[model samples]
Structure formats: structure tokens, C-alpha cells
Target: MTDPELPKLVLPGEYLGAAEQFLPGRGTYEDGGRIYASLLGVPAIDPADRTVRVEPRNAVPEVREGDLVYARVDELKTAMAVCTVLSTVASRRQVPGAPEGTVHISKAKDGYTESLAGEFAIGDVLVARVLQAHPGIKLTTAPASLGVVAARCQVCHALLTLGEKEAVCPRCGHREHRKFAKGPLPSPSGAHGPGGV
Candidate 1:
């Protein structure tokens, strides 16, 4: 039965509960001990087993290999960067499942990367190419045109501006390194760059 206290409807990426309280069932994913809806639908709980799931309202787009996509970095591990896929650059549509994607250290850039943390930070928005779509999503930002398109200053949390050598924060005058995308930089609304918005 659906929980009486939970919302009648939930959108993708909406938090449902802690992992300890309920097991994630179909249409739900657990990350960092939190359960979130993977589809736009009505949320329901199985009282018999303490599982939460979302019943989809409609069809959603699928991520395919070779597609360009925007994703947000959620965590940085030693050899991989964990991210949540946000949208497809072509259609600008939000991925329904908000599926988890990973970028191996080898796929981060064209050359050797000594550290994953140096290339990415939590919350940085990246423009990546899908290397594998099934089993598990794998991404790469190795091309000159693909990489971090938007990032905030680690010190100030203000949007970083493109610099010749690094990303600079206007507010704090902080500078940091990133594997940036080539060509035009995206505006605050993400409407200025190629295939943006």
C-alpha cells in the first residue's frame, strides 16, 4: 500500500526515504543512503516489505552510446567520478531515470590524469560523451569539445568564469583547474553554448 504520509505524485530525482527505512524497488534508486524516485509518477510503498517505488506516468527517453549529455558530479572516488545523468544535449530532455554514470580516470582527458579530484569537484556540471549505455553507463570527456562546462568556485560557491589557464571566481578571486569544453562558454542560463539549454 502507498504510504499515507508520502506525496501523491513525485518527480524524478525526488527524495523518498533513507535506505535503512525502506528498500528501493522498481522505479527507485538508492544513493548515499537515500532513496530517490527514478521516474515521474505516483510514489507507493509496499507495506509488506518496506519497499518504495514509483509508477511511471509516461514514457521517457533512453541514453544511448555516442550521445552527448550533461551530467552533474555527485562524488569523486579514487579512480572514478560518480555522476547523475541530467539531460541529453540533442533533445535537452531530462533523463527519466536520472541514471548513475561514471567516468573512469583514464577517460577523463586525452592525457594522463594524476588525480580525479583535481579534474572534477562535487556539483560540477560536465558535458560528456556516452561510451557505454547498457549494463552500466560509462562516460568520457576526452575530446577537446567535451568536459566541464559549468563549475562553481570551491572556496566561494560562485560560478567560475573561463580563464586562459583555469576557472576563476569573480567574487573570491579564486582560480582552479578543470578540463574545460572548447568554443563558447555557457551563460548563466546555459543558453549560449553549442547545444545548450
Candidate 2:
């Protein structure tokens, strides 16, 4: 059987073919006996299987083990810190699927962590490495290049600057302890620049 002609480029919601003719596959959906592209991609038609699929032109980045990521501390408990992953450092793309990660106290620092309170706090921005992506996104800030990159004054909400062994709020002069990453802050442009922090 000859392969059916397919569109070189298809946009979301664009009609592909009748469901009776082609089974909907990746990047496609079937409704009302019609197949439509679900994403911007190239449509592929398999004659043998009578399936139509669209291959996305651009793939969304996903979090993976050992990838560096930027995250904001969402909550802190005695044993762990919960964070919302902002983006991946390498691709500088927002991770798809799972955006939440957990940093166990054991992965917070090098030494024994008495509590997560001193190492992390809500709203603190950190750079961490993905330890696990499936089941759940587990993170680690124990490396020298992984830890808090930016933070705010817990009392005044002012942006804190890097200080000797801690982050200090210039406005409030409040010094908060943290597990700081070793290096300058990640660029605001989302470019993975030199330096860990």
C-alpha cells in the first residue's frame, strides 16, 4: 500500500483526516470522526497501520537526573524543603510534567543538618541538581555549586545580597543563614553564565 500524502507543517486544531481513515497518534486527537493536530508539527501517515501522527517541531524540555535547575523554596520542614522548579540551567527552559521538587535535609548540605530552617526558607531561590525525576522530582543542594542563589529578608521582604557566610538584607541588616551555592548569581536573562550561583 502506498503512504498517504501528509502536510509538511500542521498547526494545532488543524484537521488532518477522518478518524475512519487514520488512527490518531502523537500530537493528534480525534473528535467528531475527525483527526486534528494537537501541536505544531509535521504530520506523518503510516499506510500499513493507517495511523496519522504529528511530530512536534520543538520539544519541550524536561527535568532529568543530574540536571541543574533553578527553584524557589515553597515550604520548609524540619527534614525537607519543598520547592517549585523554575527552569533548567542547561536549556534554560521551564521543565514540563513535574515542576515541584523536594530536598531532603540529608541533601541540603555537606554535614549533618540539624534542621532545614537555617538552610532554606520559603521564597528563597536556589540552584539545585535533579536527583530523581520519576516517581517524584527529588533534588540536591549539597554540591558546592548548588544552593541558595537569591533570597529575601524574612522580616522586611527586601532582596538580600550575598554576605559573609550568609545572605544579608541591606535594608534591614538582617543576616539569614543559608546553604549558599559557590559562585555568582544566575544571570537574570536566563542564560547559564559562569559561576554556580
lDDT tens readout by residue for model 2, 1-197: 22347668889999999998899988899999999999998899877788889888886778877677889999998788999988988788887754789999999988899989988889998898777878789988886667988888989999899765788889989888988888653343322345422
Candidate 1: the clashing residue pairs are none
RMSD of each predicted structure: 13.0, 9.1
Candidate number with greatest lDDT:
1
Clashes of 2: 3
- Checking candidate 2 for backbone clashes, the offending pairs are 184-197, 185-197, 186-197
Give TM-scores for every candidate, taking all chains together and pairing residue i with residue i: 0.64, 0.67
lDDT tens digits, residue span 1-197, model 1 = 67886899898999999999999999999999999999899899998899999998765668887778899999999999999999988778899889999999999988899998888899999988888889999998876677898999999999999765498899999999988888643332233345532
Look at candidate 2 and tell me the lDDT of residue 89.
Answer: 82
